[model samples]
Target: MDITQDQTLDITSFFCPMTFVHTRLALDRMTSGEKLVLILNDGDARRNVAASAQALGHVIEADESLPGNRARLVIRK
Candidate 1:
C-alpha cells in the first residue's frame, strides 16, 4: 500500500548541496513513518535529493517526472 504524505517540501529553487540540505531539514522535522512529497528540478536536484535521503536510510516511495523540467519525489522518514 502507498503511504500518504504528511507534508511537502519544494526545493525547485535550490541546487546541488542546498537541495539535500533543505530536504534533510524537513525530514528532521517529521516524525518517524511520516511521508513527505518533495518537488525538485530535473537532473542534479532530482538525483542529489533522492540519493541523500536514501543514504540517510529514508524510504523513497515514488520518483516521477512532472511537466517541464521538474520531478516529484515521495520520501518516508
Candidate 2:
C-alpha cells in the first residue's frame, strides 16, 4: 500500500503515446500488490495517463503538481 517505497519510473521527457506505453509496461512488471511512480510533464499526460491507468484497472494512488509545470503520479498494480 505504501507506494513511495516501491519502484518508480520517470518519464517526464517522454510525450503522449510513449509515456503511456512506458507506464503500461512498468505496471505489467509489478506484482499485483505492488506500485509504481510515474513522473510526467504537463499537458497530454495529465489526461491520457490517468485515463489509460483507469482503463487497465490500475489504482491511481496520488496525483499532484510539482514545481515548474510537472506532475507526479503514483499508481498501483
Candidate 3:
C-alpha cells in the first residue's frame, strides 16, 4: 500500500545512534498512523534506523535507494 508521509527527516549527515535518535524523536512527536519519510546515508545508518524503528513497533512501509549512497525509509508511527 502507498502511504503519504506527514513529515520528512533528513539524517544523511548523522551517524549510528544519533541517526536513530533523531528519527525516534520525530516519530515520538507524531500521532499513531502518521507516516515519516526518513532520508539517511547508506550502511549502518540505514540498517540501524530501520531496525530500531521496527523494534519500537513502528511499521516500515518502504525502503528505497537514492541516487547517491543514501536511502529513504518510509515509516508509520
Tens digit of lDDT per residue, candidate 1, span 1-77? 46577998888988889999899889999999999999899898898888889999999999999998999999998
Give the poorly placed runs of model 3, Cα more than 4 Å off. Answer: none
Query: Tell me, what's the RMSD of every candidate?
Result: 1.6, 2.0, 1.3
Off by over 4 Å in 2: 1-3
Every model's TM-score? 0.93, 0.90, 0.94
Best by TM-score: 3
Better of 1 and 2 by TM-score: 1
Q: List the residue pairs that clash in candidate 1.
A: none
- Model 3 lowest lDDT segment of ten: 1-10
- What would the C-alpha RMSD of candidate 1 be, to one decimal place? 1.6
**Candidate 2 vs candidate 3, lDDT winner:** 3
lDDT for residue 50 in candidate 2, whole number 0-100 = 89
Per-residue C-alpha lDDT of model 3 across residues 1-77, encoded as one tens digit per residue: 46687999999988888999899899999999999999999888998999999999999999989989999999999
Residue pairs in clash, model 3: none
Q: What lDDT score goes with residue 74 in model 3? A: 97
Per residue, candidate 2 scores C-alpha lDDT tens digits across 1-77 of 34553788889888889999999888888898687888789778867998899898988888888888888888878
What's model 2's lDDT at 63?
Answer: 87
